[model samples]
Target: MPTATADVLDELVRASALLTEANSVTRLIAAMVEQANDITRSDLAAFYLRTDHSEEVSFKLSYRRGRLDSPKELATNGELVEFLEESEESVVLLERKNSPFNELLLDSNSASGVALPLVTGRSLLGVLIVNSREERFYGRARLQFLDSLARIAAGVLNNAQLYRELQEHARQIEELQRYQENVFSSMTNLLVTTDESGRVHYFNRAAAERFALDEARVGLTLKDIFGKGLTKDVFKTIDTVEQNGQTVLGLEGIYKTDEIDIDYSLNIAPLQGKRGRHEGLTLIFTDQTAESRLKQEMKVVSEERRLIKDMFSSYLSEDIVKLLVENPDLVKPGGGARNATVFFADIAGYTNFSEGKDPASIVKILNEFFEEAEPIIRRHRGYLDKYIGDCIMAVFGVPVDAGEEDTVHAVTCALELQMLVNSPRRTFFRGEAEHLRIQIGMHTGPVVAGNLGGSRRMDFTEIGDTVNVAARLEGVAVAGEIIITENTRQHLGDRFSLEERKPVEVKGKKKPIKIFNVIGIDQQSA
Candidate 1:
């Protein structure tokens, strides 16, 4: 053999050894590129692997060696990939000025090179390019030697791919097995599996603890484990499933321990052998004793609350009645200071409008107005404090913290009330209350809120400066206007469009409070 041919044979032996010992595909591909560069005497070598063979070919892996100025990342030549798809043979370029690979190799510092398509039978693996900075460096003889090397490398890579696929399948199986083990160990239900002869084959952790049995009972029969307590009915259900190969789902039973009698729901599934013969059965036991007792207790509570609601329905608003029923302590004698927002809404000029109306008609109109407005307040998490003649007082952030948006919700609720009164859909708007308008005012601060009255008859309400300020603000409002103190506006942020109004004197305050007239809600929240 000649000098070049002898060198190629030696490199092939080294390459074969590396492939046999290789554990990872990336490390193996790196070895092949390094070997190709050294044996072919090139300035740079790159292995470009085609991963997808769709309408658009994707070169997924590009490994390069022997160039100091090469790009940190790799780029592929679409034309060269197309060229390899058609040609079975290799291509050599003595000058790359007008070559198809000129653009891809522009930053590669190449003058002459050989491109060998690594293939197996008819399958295209990748392209191995060996390029040099010297012109006319690789001739026909070197190209042939590189082709032989390319053929050997491609075969090793194909086997490596098969090995990698096997590893992935093994990893997935291990993961599935681990996941099943974790799920079984974490289950709260008692699970037991037995062979056809009633010999215990498997008992999960819960089953072992519930039955007070240890590892020594693994091979014990059902009669040995449960003794005379393995009832005939339970055994019959298990036998029916094994004999007919049918499954029994959610069968309830009672198990007696020394301390208590536990109610259990069982699910039995038939197990099969290699030839589809009945082998055994799996019993899954779920304890339903606590759940059964809880349902009974809930029924009693529901009956009591129903009676409570019927008695209070005639006296209080629906939300307050429900809240007080569910949490009776909230309406007890005293209360602590709570951060809250108080909203006051009064029907403006209501006395003048009701002058000519009858007493019965006036009462009907007041009920109609409250019916339309109270739900809006409750929807925004405000508690209906009271209906003081023509005014409605609502408190937010009480009974519970309705969040920082309490003031914003109060403003939004006020805006919605005006919309409700002016709405074309209201029958009262076109009838007796036709030109009706409301003035709503809101303020957020600390207040003492709870039931307040003598033992004769207590009332759930708030009493503080916050309540006084909110009521005073309502008195200053004109018809069809929503006025809010500066304190409430500061908490409302930019959620509403506000028009600054003249300052007004409030009761029990030294300085006049500055207020804003809410023109309209913002488009985003509207």
Candidate 2:
């Protein structure tokens, strides 16, 4: 590439990174406005991005130096509004005689300004107004520069806005669907549609709501969710979806949660574009609920039905992930109460193993270990919250919620830790490496969970006393053993036999917590 071409490309890349990296609007709001101002060397720059038509509020800054926050009010005024609202769609810069901005200042001749409608394509996104104290400062070059910035800003702003809007829309859908999910979840089934690659582009409220799906089922690899337990069914489902020939509403019942025996009312709605080439499919599911959920609706679940859910990040870098998680509430803050089980699991010997192995081998083992253990984590309506060191920290209930037996679910999840270590897929070298094994620790309690952290860096993690206990417990656990507090033991009750262990002192604790070892069905609880 030519030198200038290379420089532009680099800037574009940087701009993309900047926009993509922005998890919150506030971080970039000032910087974006400032960049625009700095680009033109203008004293003041203000941005008002378009929001929904009804609101008349821009997705961005409503007002900068002065004037109403939005142009709708300015449009109500005489000249400035007319230039933007009435005048033909063309860049308009007015002098002291004809300009409202000019008329406002007594020194009228002291400065000149540029006002460009914040538009993407023909649709009016909003308006951008920049000012300079020097008169006649905005000429065609300046206007063109401002125009380019506005376009870039519009594109980035709209993209970020849409990205954010989609998140909000997803959250809204997740919320509204959650209510419907509970109502119909017992009766209504789930259906999903996707391409051959198994990228789930569409799923009904039932599919995601019931299954504890991470996102809108688009752009993610199905293996990311369905890789474990139902490998053949997963492949068969993808093939059946890709065939694009049949409308499948129901498949033989498959296990959804580790406990719930369920089936899918699979629907393959092919969405084709201009060409008849199969573009996508819609898959829906119907729950078989071994025992009808309808009868149980009146009876409150022992645990909060709300499941933990967060937008997945492994597929994308942390930056876009933050944007996806945060953009939804660009205009509004948080409003929702969710009850979920937070889970934290980590390999007990990962650090020791890491010390012995090469960087590549360590990473390889980590990936391999995650690949092996992740499915078990998901089996109990648990989400892979994050991987910390050799440990995996996850939550059972927040990105979505776990309706019944959350404690039961989380405990059972803890019990499965040994299976993760012993799985043949897990490769441990001979000798010292042979000692490496995984440990799981979990606790159950209510917590306020949501997309947390910040723009530069952020993560979807659950926070609460329960989450902390789980983390500390995971650290204290011995290899191949699932350690849980008595609180969790109570939830499991007679469902499974557990062995009691002497109380152990944990950090920042005033009392010792009685722990338990989950033994086999044949073992005694005592």
lDDT winner among the candidates?
1
How well is each residue in 358-417 modelled by candidate 1, as lDDT tens digits?
989888888888888877887777777889998999988776665568787788888899
Q: Count the backbone clashes (under 3 Å) in each candidate.
A: 0, 41
* TM-score, model 1 to reference: 0.56
Best by TM-score: 1
Write candidate 2's Cα lDDT for 1-526 as tens digits: 1125455455445544665566665555555565556655666667655455675433345545432222322333446435554542434444445544452222323355676765665566666666666667676555655565566666666676677779999999999978865664454556555664557765555566666675654677666666653447656765665675565554555655474446543444555666577776655554656336665763433211111113453422344334434443311223234555655666665675677567887776677667756666666656677777677777665454545466666666766667656766555433445567767776767766655766766555567777788778877778777777877766665777777888888887799988887764434542
Candidate 1 residue pairs in backbone clash:
none
Per-candidate TM-score against the hidden true structure: 0.56, 0.36
User: Looking at model 2, how many pairs of residues clash?
Assistant: 41
Residue 258's lDDT within candidate 2 is 75
Question: What would the C-alpha RMSD of candidate 1 be, to one decimal place?
Answer: 9.3
Query: Model 2 reaches what TM-score against the true structure?
Result: 0.36
Worst 10 residues of 2 by lDDT: 301-310
